[model samples]
Target: MGKWMRSAIQRQKQFYIQQLMQSGLVNDHERLEQWTMAELRREYERFNPAYNAEGGSRHGQTSPRTGEAHH
Candidate 1:
């Protein structure tokens, strides 16, 4: 793969690991060893409020004066 592609892949892996840690899936060495990328992604998406459209109401709601949402 190209350098940029490799870098992106590495960054994505790092992001997944961080998300897994935050989700309380991989607590330590043993859990980390047993965790899979698919499982991590699923859990992260499940717990992520941004993934739910209803949960995004705060972002979509606009300020009357500014006529803009926080995004």
Candidate 2:
């Protein structure tokens, strides 16, 4: 990758790293540094409230508490 591309990726990774750390999903910065950007993003999104806010209906599943699909 070019210098700019690498710099961008590093910045994006830093964002995810901070998010993951704040979410308590990651404790070791060294291990996080070894992760690919895609991996970091996936982990961050997994715990991100907005990413999960779409609810189960959109994902083709029913809610466990109500046994009803979200709308």
Candidate 3:
């Protein structure tokens, strides 16, 4: 996930979103610096609650990701 997720799309939009991010169309450069796979998984959860980052939940908001890293 990114720091400021100003926008979120459905899972079907993943491909287009990635293309936009990589092409600078998303405009979240700062987020890229501190981005992590774990965070990405969390964002995925917002789309699919059953989604798991590490085979389990990070307790919704207790993870370090809930700090200033959020948008």
Candidate 4:
């Protein structure tokens, strides 16, 4: 059980690291690997355009059918 949990956590970290790299947030693999999962998630969300300042999805602000911001 412990091994499986550890593996899952590792996978999540790697996933976030890959996303950060793809988003041009981090350039060094070694440095990224040194960061904790929480740090990785924080940084990832900080750069995510869909998230508002309160960390809520911005989708609600847009009209579902038109895909335009609600005025």
- Candidate with maximal TM-score: 2
- Candidate 1 has its poorest 10 consecutive residues by lDDT at 62-71
Provide backbone clash counts, one per model. 0, 0, 2, 0
Candidate 3 Cα RMSD after full superposition onto the native fold (Å)? 11.6
Per-candidate TM-scores read 0.49, 0.73, 0.28, 0.70
**Per-residue C-alpha lDDT of model 4 across residues 1-71, encoded as one tens digit per residue:** 69999999999999989997897757888888988888787666656776545666543454332244532
User: Distance from true position, residue 8, model 1, in Å?
Assistant: 0.5
Worst 10 residues of 3 by lDDT: 62-71
Local accuracy of candidate 2 as per-residue lDDT tens digits, 1-71: 89999999899999999998887756898888888888787666555677777532245344332254533
Q: Which regions of candidate 4 deviate over 4 angstroms? A: 53-71
Better of 3 and 4 by TM-score: 4
Write model 3 residue lDDT over 1-71, tens digit each, in one string.
Answer: 66345344333345434643654423564553355545554554533434444445343444344353321
Model 1 agreement with the true structure over 1-71: per-residue lDDT tens digits: 99999898667666776875776645563454455556555545544667745554344444332244433
lDDT, candidate 3, at 35: 50
Error of 4 at 16 (Å): 0.6
lDDT for position 62 in model 2: 47
| Cα lDDT, model 3, residue 17 | 41
lDDT for predicted candidate 2 compared with the true structure: 0.71
lDDT of 3 at 16: 36
